[model samples]
Target: MTASTEGATDTAATTDSGPTSLDTGSETGHQTTAGGDTDGSKPDLGAAPDEHCANPGPWPLPEAPLLELPRFVAHSYIDLDQIGWMTKFRSSVGHDYSDAFERCRSMKHYAYPIDEVDWGAVELYAPVAGEVIVVEQERYGSRVQLRSTLHPEIDFVLFHVDLMGPLAPGATIAAGELLGTHYGDQTYSDIAAATTVDGAWRLISWFELMTDDLLAVLQARGGISSPSDIIITQAERDAMALCCTNGQFDDPEELSDWVPLDAGNLAQPTRLGLATLDDDDGRLR
Candidate 1:
């Protein structure tokens, strides 16, 4: 939960200095799912090649997780862009890089689910089975830090939520189990995942962990057109410099610092999994 936070939730105030050091995964020769990804020809996410990781992730977890959350604008960045989070950002003080680049980390992991059901009426469920290791109280709500049994190194959390019932350390939860509702009467929402990779903290997109079947379910419901809907790679974000420096959009010509998702008028779908290509020649791309 964030203290005095509005849109997205976080306990610690993020600094430009960065959290310890973010492992962009560039060093691991981070595996991409498809051959086209190797040449940057395909936009995809690499599966952490494990015999089986359920979901492999090493995003940073606070020695304790630990901010006012930004007034959330929308469900997914795509919808926020396609649909809009206008009411919140219009009244913005500093969220979404509106202020002095305060908490990019929060933004990095922040996700407003795009499910069409009534948000207020819906009960939040655990995306995967795990144990409630710690529940941190934030001004916006409770941050349930769930350590996945399937992927022990990865920690999952649904920010700004009120659990269906009380939970304590070691309390077990199964996938799709009722966690709770978004913190009572909350205006904004988000879900975040993290893990310690290379003994360092890295924030990851929660969508990366969902099974293919689960993703298919969401796709069929029109919640997400594709896995790429909610994913933005660290390498991609840095290359785009998605946020403003020192919190200032600074550019007189630009009204906001956020990069428009459809700025490229993409004809091909951006995806998070690798694609195997068939080639007559030896070219990887």
Candidate 2:
């Protein structure tokens, strides 16, 4: 039913261009079963010129997304030293500073502060193909919202971004497409995953959605054994009290001296629903 775009079938161009086009060759979606082939017969993929291949990225939509860092570098400030999940922080209104110990609370949130890194030259890639939802300009950058194509139930927001081009509603986005360029001397952004519950959109813990493989990749690049070592705990809070009168480690680097907790116990498993977490077929990694 879906028409194949011109040059879409060319494997060489597809690889060079990063699969900007989707192949709609079969009416039932030309995907193979877990085994080599359903009938135990290998599908003829011609040669490199005529080969047909599936898009590389996440699987079964976005349950356990294969995420690329905002920047192309294997590692960035997003390293274990800068990321935080389930950490207690002061809630401020209108960007006003508040008491850290008295106003601190724990909520599911992820923060990556790439303040020292130069991201102005890097292109931001769309984590998934989705419709543009909201666009807002901020002091340091622009905030763009996209309705996830993989999961209509979830909404994704990218803060502190400079869009590559104008993206209006109803426009189709391709996975791995360059959404925009990030520009800033001191840049930081939060990628939040929200879902509607009881008719209201609430922030959900994405820490669990981060797959073990991805975590290992990050850990290797971050020069740490586990990403979970960054998760703040009551003991970390006590350590902060020893240094600061207010008991707050405003700079994440302050906690670098603390020992990394048992990563295996801290990591939350992926929540599987309609989608699966299998890449054993060696087709979708």
lDDT of 2 by residue, 143-183 (tens): 56665666665555555577778876567766557777654
Candidate 2 vs. true structure, TM-score: 0.44
CA RMSD per model (angstroms): 16.6, 19.8
Output the lDDT of residue 199, model 1: 43
Give the residue spans of candidate 1 off by over 4 A. 1-119, 244-285
User: How do the residues 152-189 of candidate 1 rate in per-residue lDDT, one tens digit apiece?
Assistant: 66665565666667877678977677767655333444
Local accuracy by lDDT, each model: 0.38, 0.35
